[model samples]
Every structure is written in structure tokens, then in C-alpha cells.
Target: METTRYSVPFSPLQERIAREAPQLSAALNHLLQAMGASDFEKYINSLSALKKVDDHLLLITKKEMYRSVLTGRFLPVIKECFAVKFVRIVSQ
Candidate 1:
């Protein structure tokens, strides 16, 4: 007997997310390096840019601790780097 396989297609939003994730990571890495915070680059792998709204950017992190660190230490730098008025960091 032969088995058949079916492929699932990604929606436009899914495609946009898939495309944006790596770009977000790269952008963060570059920003961190440029700011001489290369030590923080490792954390970039755990972050994902969910979406943007008005002047704000929504970011998600894999750990709750990262949320605090990012918000407290890096929020201002991130806003400057992305030219965003606000940033919301959420943990998974």
C-alpha cells in the first residue's frame, strides 16, 4: 500500500511572521553590537517580534526573566534603534 502526504499552506500573516522573525533577530543583534552590548546578543535568539501597532512594537520572549531584563535594561536602546515610540515585551 502507498501512503499519500498532504501539504499545508501558510496564511499571509504566517508568511509575514516567518519572514520577519529572522530579520528582527538580525536587527537586534546588529543593534546590540553597535551599542557595545555584544554580551546581550545571545538573548536575541529567544526573542520574536510579534507585530507593530501605531508607534509601538510588540516583542515576545521565551522566558519571563528575559522580559524583565529586556524591558528594564534594553527598552530605551530598542526604542532608539527601531525608532519606535513604545515597545511591549511579553513572555511565552
Candidate 2:
């Protein structure tokens, strides 16, 4: 008899974030609250993924358009939530 094998799809960055910084959800919630409106919150939540690396955070996305828009519009706000060196975005 032959058996088929299946693999689980997992994201290392996300896993690391969950394991290393469980408080990230509260930080993200605070960031969202600072955005001050639902639309902005929705847009940010839809566009990127954030991972805490050492003392910094990495924001990544698959779309350059979204990355560009986010980097242009909310980079300052993100920096305010973290140190300037702690926040960054990259296309994945």
C-alpha cells in the first residue's frame, strides 16, 4: 500500500513573533487605536505582517503597492509605536 503525505504550511516569522512576543497583540491593538479610525485600522491589518526580531520589529508584505502605501502613509506612526530602528517594512 502507498500512502500520501501532507505538509503543514507555517510562517516562521509569525511563529517567532507569537513565541517571542506574545504581547505584540496588545501593542498592535494600541497602534490601531492610535490610528483613530476604522478604515485606517482595516487597511493596516489587511496589508502586512509584523514580527519582533531582537529589540526590533519587522513588517513584511507580499505586495509592493501595499508596502509602498504603508511605508508612505503610516511609517511615522509605526515608528512612534517602536523606536525608529525597531520598525521597518520589507517586500516578501
Candidate 3:
């Protein structure tokens, strides 16, 4: 079997995201629900979840499975909840 590993380089931004991970996840869930995207709640829960960085919302995930699944499909909805310039999906 072959295994693919994912890693996130350490940085101040990464640390900030780590600290606010839970709160950010909750806020995102609430926002998704408020926008009548309740159906996506379950899906979002499965992924690593999101956090707001300087001018972007970073989607952190460990598994390659989700990295491929997330893409930028939710960028618009995410922007509605967060006023970031972009949404980036990165592996941790």
C-alpha cells in the first residue's frame, strides 16, 4: 500500500489558526445554517474545517480525501460568513 502524507509548515498564521480552530468551526457552522445550507453542515463537519487568516479563510485538512473533495465549491458561501479575499484549502 502507498501512503501520502500531508504537512503544514509552521508559521504565526498557522499558530493563530490552531488557537482559534474550534471557535472558527462553530462560527462557520452557524453561518452555514443561517444561510440555509444546513445540508452542508454534515459535510463541513467531516472536513478539517476553516479558520480566518490575514486576508483569507484557510481550510485545513489532514486527509487527501477531503483536500480533493473541498476544492473551491464553497468559496462564495464562505465569503458570506467571512470577508476574506480568498479561500485556501491546505493540508495539515
Q: Pick the candidate with the highest TM-score.
A: 2
Per-residue alpha-carbon lDDT of model 2 for 3-90, expressed as tens digits? 9999865444324445766767566656677776663444555544676666677777777776787778877787776544666778
Please provide, for model 3 over 3-65, each residue's C-alpha lDDT reduced to its tens digit, 9 standing for 90 to 100. Answer: 999998544322343476655655565556754554354345445655677777777766665
lDDT of 1 by residue, 1-92 (tens): 99999986533322444566555545454556755644354444445435666678887777888888878777888777666898889998
Best by lDDT: 2
Number of the candidate with higher TM-score, 1 or 3: 1
- Angstrom error of the Cα, residue 86, model 3: value is 1.5
Q: 72, model 3: CA deviation in Å?
A: 4.0
Whole-model Cα lDDT of every candidate shown, in order: 0.64, 0.65, 0.59
Candidate 1 lDDT score at position 76: 81
